[model samples]
Target: MIGEGVAVRIIPCLDVRGGRVVKGVKFRDHVDMGDILERAAAYRDQGADELVFYDITASPEGRSVDVAWVERVAEAIDIPFTVAGGIRDVARARAVLHAGADKISVNSPALARPDLVAELADAFGSQCVVIGIDSIRENGRYRLRANTGDPDNMTDPDLDTRAWVERVQALGAGEIVLNCMDADGVRSGYDIDQLADVRGICDVPLIASGGAGTPEHFLDVFRRADVDGALAATVFHSGQIEIPDLKRWLGEQGVRTRTGSVAS
Candidate 1:
């Protein structure tokens, strides 16, 4: 169960490819959404608790996130935000943070070199480091995959999902964002069973990503898995769900969310 009185954060995720916000089913066949800065500012004004910006191609292309946009986003929104993709070392992480991100998320690079997690945590504090895990269920057990679960780049690290969660925490990760590959952009609902398994082992904040289709889905994850936050991309980007309305509805269901004025 989630700690009592812990307010659940509602976050909107922006997956950037070629500097445009994009959404894809199962992390492929992405379609452009809109300009990044416009979307970021809109979500902030909509009362989003936080925002997540992912440069989806950075790792696959062997480059770091463009810090120019990071600086622009920081100047655009008042809410805290996280930047992920291709952040492999302390220097790259520092550049992202210095550009105004409240947190830096590491996925593929951390999988390649696990020590990078401790290195960033040592230099910037654990609270500034977030580990993004892309996972899929295979043979009734969870497995970790690298490269944002892109099929061509998919390589099983041969690490159990639960065990990896424990390892990252030991390495000083302050939070974990678990992206269920099977559930990514499917919109049926969050992977409750997967999330519950992680919550059982994760001591730090756990943000549930992938498979958020409706406001009810958010309610279900918070009520069932006890995650610290629920993150959605397609729903928010496609106007299927709005943050203020979602937060208001969740609060009505007895989920403690940070109160904000709902757009009339």
Candidate 2:
């Protein structure tokens, strides 16, 4: 199911802070947009397969995940949602799950212990855990970035991506979210080639984040990256592209997406 014409996913990401739905410009520009409920409801109605809620500044200094906000958003969205921000351990992960999130994305915490992935898998199902990776092309080479990668730890060189994949998989992570920090918002498109390279080495589902400017950008990712899902933040938040329109566009471009509405 991983290819250009497969049932490619069009996922909208909501960057949150202080319990408010905010949109950032390239992982650095922070601006509040509206209440979480409205934006999430909009994405769900727009026909997104799923939505991502990221607490943009959850981990500058080992901060804890925002539980109340997660709970609120989980209660608000109809489609499955992932809450990630300062998820560093099993306890925090459990809290996120209990708050109603279908999935929890892990970053710095996984890098630190590596075993947290397995621990979370044992506690929650493997499907509940997604490993978020931030990659950058330096001197024509893509390397991992340690800060919440892709507007995600949000850190430094942590060995190679291949090694990280092996360890995280052994630890029982169910999916890998390859986010190119370098491509965060140039809007050119996703680093499908980069994600494809990561996919070639990993068996888990790969969610390609960063660098989505247009519907064509999404098509390029699905066609070239062989990813399970494509996540975008700004276009969705800034009102450049609507979710239903994007999904319909994907369908027109020969990408598979569920045909239904929030009210349906």
Candidate 3:
């Protein structure tokens, strides 16, 4: 169960690729799910606490995020939604915010230029910035990828995940989204140990991403890691688990959550 005071957030991620929402395993083998605007509104109607719109292929394809598409989704959904991908500088971040996105999520660009985190926090307030760290455990240690960018451009420093979290927080990131590459789309459970380690290092809110298949998996993460929020894509898109049902079950388990209006 989550601790006293703060309510746990249930966020649904819409991994957009080429203007369409897609879901994949370990960020590969993606299948088109639906139109971005339609899915965003559906999640909001389903009582999602917040929606995350990730342009999954933006960086790899060397294209800026489709600001026009973002405008369309923002106009369609009443709830807060985050827009990410190819947000390389404050100008791009500003453009997304102007397009009506409530927040901007950054990955590899932040790793390559740590100053961007501080710059964004300084310009738009820390709350508007989310630092996403994607990791995979190997050789008894965790290595990170900023995001799936071109192989030639990606620099795998394989930095320690915990240390990296601390750095980002110090750089003024208001939230951390820890993505476990190994657990991503596997649907087994969240990376509890990994979340705990990152949580211990930073005082900022942590969102555990990847591997959320069952409602029980959420309960486990809340009880064990005490993450501020949980993010999933395939399960929600597949209709295997609905946000309202999950929140209701969580409430029954003594976890405080915002159930929104309750989906009819």
Candidate 4:
């Protein structure tokens, strides 16, 4: 943030469950907020550079691609969006893209196949692939978390976050959306140590998600590590922080951002 650098994006995340925007902490604090299209339009008008639509219910239900509603939100917003959760294959990825998503984010699918990322990237371009890696702090060290979506939880299926970051990049991942569920909806702050691990291992652009609760939280993440963007749900959705105010604060903190004329 101190020098000339790549623009750090203020990305908004919409964790959609049953056609409603929901806020949950470590995948636990599920709160039905509002309609997806309504929130997407508000953020687009509020100067959000991009949006991420996550089907938070996909995991528990065993289905994916909230295609109908995704299309609606995409049609309502001018900025691009990255859709994730339960996108298991290229065909499904294509369906979401056809629905108006600018990018496809796959977490469990890529890890299960490892080749899925390459296939999707080869099929659609690298920029269209965003791999979500959930990491958490544990036992005085940072570790990659699997399946739980809660950063604090861990299981034997876990892979080393940094090691997999390198592997995913080689597998043709264009960017990594590092999310720490422990910080999700907590409004505390991002996992700096965890973000540092991903930032250190990832060569492509990195997006830091989870733990953003205030305007100062945005500045804190970028200042602590080299990240391409910041993604938040509760704060932005609850009106605890506004995109325009976040950008202004980042600028004051020496972080460069898209200086567009905010529509709101």
Candidate 5:
């Protein structure tokens, strides 16, 4: 599934908080990293397949995504970019797309109103709608967690990750980004079992996010799990793993990836 011109993407994430890129451990205690536009351009030049700008505090703050920032980032980078956080309805999604984002991702809002997923897909096409699932493992099962809370304390027993993935896909999500709440920023590795669970059931492009510490972690997930792409912030942001170097390594190991120009 990897070789033979099939490209696995390496996406650099910009977790924006207060209009700046930040990194947090397990979605808490975030520290400012740097300017968003600067980081976006740098990643684009560094050969990132795509850029994902997540307003880390938008949904919690209950506000619309920053269209102006999206416009600026789009202008600075040549690769496809995605904007998520605080996008609740068709109008907001449209605004983000109009601002030059290639896609709009929704997390908490999609859970609150699943219909909005279909609505956005209908208006902007399914390719434009990305369903971001933030999941935490609990009681030996993966549970959905939106906004913020302790993983042990938070658990939606009724809606497991697999069920939600199928539901969102059926609801019109063109892509699924599975973010591991437990592994987020842990730098250990991705939740392989959980990702495999969703991957086995999901047909759309699946992006595995969270716990990317070493390049081997990326290789492991792509090899062990049925994921199309892998996303990481701290590793890329802190210069721990260079995109070109990572791609080269993957290519050397027979893993196909877009090392030049974004794959789209």
Candidate 6:
């Protein structure tokens, strides 16, 4: 059961490609937003509980994350942040952490080798290992897809979504970022039913990503799915929803959230 006093975190996601923040619908047609450091600092001051940075092209291009940018972001923001993309081994994960990232997220590589989760957890403790699962609903069933949900990487026909979540938890993952590919940038609302299903099997903190368009959406996900955090990229990046205001709205509706400036 989720703790009653744990505040629901509001997180901003920055999807970077070639070192610039980008936003797109369902992981296609990405448009550059702005300088990564500028956006990171803006969100931190806006009261975001944490930030998520993903090098959108790293997995597809077959390379590791650029530690240089991670270091810059670490210097720019005082809040905790997670770095993802092409983090496949313990050594690479160590480098990112040493570069000042609070956590490292693994997706495509973890799908190919499940033991990597165990190895990371063993080396850095479960708290530092975050498993990012990009899922799509297919014919009434949720299926796992990787490589940022590219069709070419959708070759795992038998990978069950629920099973994968359960397996990762057993492997010692401390958190799960469930990115609903179908809802990636639509911003209608979160895939509540899907989040609830994943929430059922997830033991660690669950972060809901995709389809967050309004303050109500965040409230719904928290009340319906019992998620520990809500993450958004398009809404936050475009300034459609400000973190401080969103947190204030959630608070007005009786949701527990961190108020005022994020602690340095």
Worst 10 residues of 6 by lDDT: 148-157
> Could you give candidate 3's per-residue lDDT for residues 109-171 as a string of tens digits?
898889999999999999999998988897888888765634445557668887788898999
What is the per-residue lDDT of model 1 for residues 30-107, given as tens digits with 9 covering 90 to 100? 888989989988897888899999988899878989999899889977889999998999999999999999999998
- Global lDDT of each model? 0.90, 0.80, 0.86, 0.81, 0.86, 0.89
**TM-score-better candidate, 1 vs 3:** 1
| Model 6: per-residue Cα lDDT at residue 36 | 94
- Candidates' RMSD to native: 2.5, 2.9, 2.4, 2.8, 2.8, 2.3
Q: What does candidate 2's lDDT look like per residue over 78-117, in tens digits?
A: 7788887788878888888999999998876677777788
On TM-score, who's better, 2 or 6? 6
Q: Cα lDDT of model 1 overall?
A: 0.90
1-264: candidate 4 lDDT, tens digit per residue = 346756889998888888888877555778888888888888888889999988876743558867998789778778889998888888898999999889999887677679999999999999999998877666665566555543343343466777888999998999999987668657788877788767887889899987887777788789887788988877888788888888877887788987768663
Candidate 5 residue 96 C-alpha distance from true site, Å: 0.5
List candidate 5 segments past 4 Å from native: 1-3, 149-157, 261-264
The residue-by-residue lDDT of candidate 6 on 144-192, one tens digit each, is 8877635455555368789999999999999999999788778899999
Candidate 2, poorest ten consecutive residues by summed lDDT: 149-158
Candidate numbers sorted by TM-score from highest down: 1, 6, 3, 5, 2, 4
Pitting candidate 4 against candidate 6, the one with the higher lDDT is 6
Error (Å) of candidate 6 at residue 120 is 0.3
